[model samples]
Structures are given as structure tokens and as C-alpha cells.
Target: MTAVVRHVMVRGRVQGVGYRAWVDHEARAKNLEGWVRNLRDGSVEAVFAGAEDVVTAMITACRRGPSLARVDAVQEEAGNPDALNLRRAGERFSVLPTV
Candidate 1:
């Protein structure tokens, strides 16, 4: 499996809608290594790392977030797998404090 990493920025009505929790659950279920957090500008940011296809699938899922979320945009770009900026050591997936 070819591994890849992606940094994503999700815009729109994502906050206060269990978006982070949903992402945490989904990424872990997909065996992805990453972190999700809320940004200062009312946006959500996340990093996903794993097999290319799986990561791609995760991004697609983000576009249609949780039932309560109204995802407007999903911006994705290449990420550095070696430096995912994980909050705690040895954690597979994390929900980081808002930034």
C-alpha cells in the first residue's frame, strides 16, 4: 500500500455539530493516523495519513460530514507524514484543542 498524507481545511457550519468527534471516529475506524481541530476562523482542520486510497476516501467522507454539519468546502493538500503534529506521543488519532 502506497502511503500518503493530506492536510485538510473544512469550511462552513462545521463547528458545534460534533464534526471533530465524527472525524476522530472515522479516521480511527479507517486506521488512519492524524489529528483534527477547530481553527480560529470557525473552520476545522485535519491531517490524515495512511494508504493513499484510504486517505482519499477519508477526504471524501469529510465533504459530507456528520448529519448535523453543513460542509461548504473541503480544501485538501499534501501533508508531511513524518510530522503530523500529533498532540500526544504514540496516539493514532487525536482531537486537538481549538486553535
Candidate 2:
């Protein structure tokens, strides 16, 4: 399997709506490695690293988020695993503090 990483920014009513937690659950369920966090601008940002297909699926899931999230737009770009910013040494996934 080809390993890949992606950085995604989710917009539209994403904050205070369990988006981060939802992402955390979804990513872990897919056995992905990365982190999600709230941005100061009210968007939610995330990095997903794993098999290309699994990471792609995770991004599709983000477009729908939790039932409560508006999810107006999802911007994506290639990501580097070296920039993951994981919370701990061996964490598989994490919900990071807001930036």
C-alpha cells in the first residue's frame, strides 16, 4: 500500500461543535496517525497519515463531520509526515490544543 499524508482545513461552524473529537474518533477508527485541532479563525485543521486509501476516506468523512457540524468547505493539500505535530512520542491520533 502506498503511504500518504494530507493536511485539511475545515470551515463553517466547526468550532465548539465536537468537530475535533469527532475527527479524533473517526481517524483512530481508520487506524490513521495524525492530529486535529481548532484554529484561531474558527476553522478546524487536521493532518492524516496512513495508507492513501484510508487517508482519502478520512477526508471524505470530514466533509460530513458530526451531525452538528456545518462543514461548508473542506480545503486539502499534500502533507508531510515530518510535520504531523503529534502530542506524544507514540500516539496514533490526537486532538490537539487550539492554535
lDDT of 1 by residue, 1-99 (tens): 899989999999999999999999999999999999999999999999999999999999999999999999999999987658665678999899998
Which parts of model 2 are misplaced by more than 4 Å? Answer: none
Q: Summing lDDT over every window of 10 consecutive residues in candidate 2, give the lowest-scoring window.
A: 81-90
Pick the lDDT winner: 1
TM-score of 2: 0.95
Q: What C-alpha lDDT does candidate 2 achieve relative to the native structure?
A: 0.92
> lDDT (CA) for every model shown?
0.94, 0.92
Candidate 2 per-residue C-alpha lDDT over 43-67 given as tens digits, one digit per residue, 9 for 90 to 100 = 9999999999999999999999999
Cα deviation of 50, candidate 1, in Å: 0.1
Clash totals, every prediction: 0, 0
